[model samples]
Structure formats: C-alpha cells, structure tokens
Target: MQAIIFVRLFRLLLGRQGPLLLSLLLWTALGI
Candidate 1:
C-alpha cells in the first residue's frame, strides 16, 4: 500500500525532477 502510494506521488511530481529527486533523497536519508 505504501509503495503504491509512493509510486503515485512519485509520478505526480515527475515534472519537477530536480526537486522531486532531492526531496526523495532527503527523506530516504532521514530514514523516515
């Protein structure tokens, strides 16, 4: 369920790749 939502949100934000990647990377790094 989490992964499914994540994929959806990921695609929703795809147009802003730079910010999206940075945010995802930051969130992942924070262990959230």
Candidate 2:
C-alpha cells in the first residue's frame, strides 16, 4: 500500500542523509 512505499522512500533517504535528515524531520514534527 501507500505506507509501504512511504517506508521504502524513507529508508532510501535515511541511507543518504541519515542523522541530519532525521533530526530535521523530528524538528519539523515538533514544530507542527
């Protein structure tokens, strides 16, 4: 489903930026 595709995309991003991107995402979530 869509969730599976999202997870795959997230894993691909994590493989690239990893910590920086993760922190940015967390901060954005907290900000929201």
Candidate 3:
C-alpha cells in the first residue's frame, strides 16, 4: 500500500539525517 512507501521514505530520511530532519519536518508541518 502507499503507507509502506511512506515508511520507506522515513527510513531513508533517517539514514541520511539521523532524526533531526524528521523532527524539523514535523515541526514545520505543525507550524503551518
């Protein structure tokens, strides 16, 4: 399902930026 694709994307992001980028994205979304 498309949900799995999102999980993969998150894992890829974790590999690249470790966890800060994830929090940054979440914060930006919450702010908007």
Which candidate leads the pack in lDDT? 2
Query: Could you tell me every candidate's TM-score relative to the true structure?
Result: 0.45, 0.55, 0.43
User: How much does each candidate deviate from the true structure in C-alpha RMSD?
Assistant: 3.3, 2.3, 2.5
- Local error of candidate 1 at 2, Å? 28
Write candidate 3's Cα lDDT for 1-32 as tens digits. Answer: 98789778888878977679778778976996
**Over 4 Å off in model 1, which ranges?**
1-16
Superior candidate under lDDT, 1 versus 2 = 2
Residue-by-residue lDDT tens digits, candidate 2, 1-32: 99789768888979967888778878986996
Candidates' C-alpha lDDT: 0.77, 0.82, 0.80
Over 1-32, each residue of candidate 1 has an lDDT whose tens digit, in order, gives 89889767777777667686868767997999
How do the candidates rank by TM-score, highest first?
2, 1, 3
**Candidate 2 accuracy as lDDT:** 0.82
- Residue 15, candidate 1: how far off, in angstroms? 10
Q: Model 3, which residues run further than 4 Å from truth?
A: 16-32
